[model samples]
Target: MTVVGIGYVGLSAALLLSQYNKVYALDISPEKIYKLNKKISPLKDT
Candidate 1:
């Protein structure tokens, strides 16, 4: 599955779906992509 955007909803959906399927996340920000590629979460936990 290809997920466009890595915002809250997109990231959440991708993470959930990834458990059972292959997921590819996309975003406009290269920084965000880089972070994700490095196994980092762009969203901070409160």
Candidate 2:
């Protein structure tokens, strides 16, 4: 499945669904893509 937008919400949802599905996260932001590729949070929620 494809999950557009790799934000916190998208990431969480993708992770949950990834257990039984292949998630292809799409985003226009390079930073977000970079962080996700490196397994890092793009935004600081704290």
Candidate 3:
């Protein structure tokens, strides 16, 4: 699946859906994209 806008919801969905199929996440922020590519969560956990 090709998912555009890898923000909170998109990233969550991509992570969930990826278990059963291929997932591609896209975002406008290059920094966020780079962070995600490195397996880093852009959002901070409480």
- TM-score per candidate, in order? 0.89, 0.80, 0.86
For residues 1-46, write the lDDT of model 3, one tens digit per residue.
9899887798899999999999988888999889988988987777
Q: Summarize candidate 2's per-residue lDDT along 1-46 as a digit string, tens digits.
A: 9999877899888999999988898999999999889998787777
Span of 10 residues, lowest total lDDT, candidate 2: 37-46
lDDT of each: 0.94, 0.88, 0.89
lDDT of 1 by residue, 1-46 (tens): 9999999999999999999999999899999899999999999878
The parts of candidate 3 lying over 4 Å away from their true place are: none
The TM-score, computed over Cα atoms with residue i paired to residue i, of candidate 1 is 0.89
lDDT of 1: 0.94
RMSD of each: 1.0, 1.2, 1.1
- Looking at model 3, the pairs that clash are none
What C-alpha lDDT, on a 0 to 100 scale, does residue 44 get in candidate 2? 79
